[model samples]
Target: MATKKRKKISQAFTKSQLVKEISERCDLNKNQVTHVLDEMKDIIASHLKKNGPEKFTLPGILKIQVRNVDAKPSREGINPFTKEPTVYPAKAASRKVRVTPLKQLKEMA
Candidate 1:
């Protein structure tokens, strides 16, 4: 048997892409840009889960927020993986997002 090799995709977009963007806008290295983005993900996830999403603004970046909502499980009655019939229970959850693009994005296309 033969195994196929797969290409590796850099995390949070390619390092080159991130490094180029960050380097063009700020005095940061490729490694620094990578580190900052990784840390930012942790911070965002933690805030949304623990303290709730907060509206924040970074230069040239959009505002972000976390919204809590009551989520209802599938009422259609079905087992997705097996396609068997079943009732899905309702639940709650918090959804996080960047809201700044709402208006501009809607207007674009």
Candidate 2:
């Protein structure tokens, strides 16, 4: 039996590249594209802060939700490098954002 090798995929889009691409597609200036992106970020942040861990969806694109995580209890652990025993302190609860692609986006992929 022979195994097939999987292909490696490597590509990334930076903020500047995103602005340029959006500007070109929408026939808008780079500044305008950047402004729109900035506004979107602000709007999402404000909504999350106000609502406290709710879902926000962009139709046919993606869904984003903020989640509140509970605190972790303290525990004893060892330092890998020094091989020394240590007491790990408890961690306070934190918030995290989760993203999920919508059906349309998933189909495209």
Candidate 3:
């Protein structure tokens, strides 16, 4: 089967443009599309909560996860240019959001 080639986008679509296009394609009103998008945002946020599931998957599109990063201790190091001793500041442990594209999303690119 032949597949249609997609036009390369020079810039990202704005929220309003995205909503407009989705509404037209889905046969829904702009407000309805906006509501649906907002709900999706809320659902993803809830899923990545501290006590809730740290991972969320939109099948065939992407997976989002919250990962814990280990803290780094301060250390002494030599300055490359000056050849002098210096102390590197310690970094506090933090959580980060990681997004991985799925197979279908990768294929679309």
- Tell me, what's the RMSD of every candidate? 11.6, 9.5, 3.5
Candidate 3 residue spans exceeding 4 A from truth:
1-10
lDDT of 3 by residue, 1-109 (tens): 3344555668899999899877766778999999999999999999999988999999999999999999999999999999999999999999999999999999988
How many clashes in each structure?
0, 0, 0
TM-score for each predicted model, relative to the true structure:
0.45, 0.67, 0.86
Best by lDDT: 3
Sorted by TM-score (best first), the order is 3, 2, 1
Q: Could you tell me the C-alpha RMSD of candidate 1 in Å?
A: 11.6
Order of models, best lDDT first: 3, 2, 1
Candidate 2 wrongly placed segments (more than 4 Å): 1-10, 50-53, 75-89
For model 2, how does the per-residue alpha-carbon lDDT over 1-109 read when each residue is reduced to its tens digit?
3344534536666999879867776778999999999999887777678454477788899998888899999999999989999999999999888899999999987
lDDT for each residue of candidate 1 in 1-109, tens digit (9 for 90 to 100): 3334534646665667767776556766778887888898777667656465465544354566665565766576778799999877677665646456555555654
RMSD of 3: 3.5
Q: What is the Å distance of residue 49 in model 3 from its true position?
A: 1.5
Report the lDDT of model 2 for residue 24.
Answer: 70
Reference-based TM-score, model 3: 0.86
Q: How accurate is candidate 3 locally (lDDT)?
A: 0.92
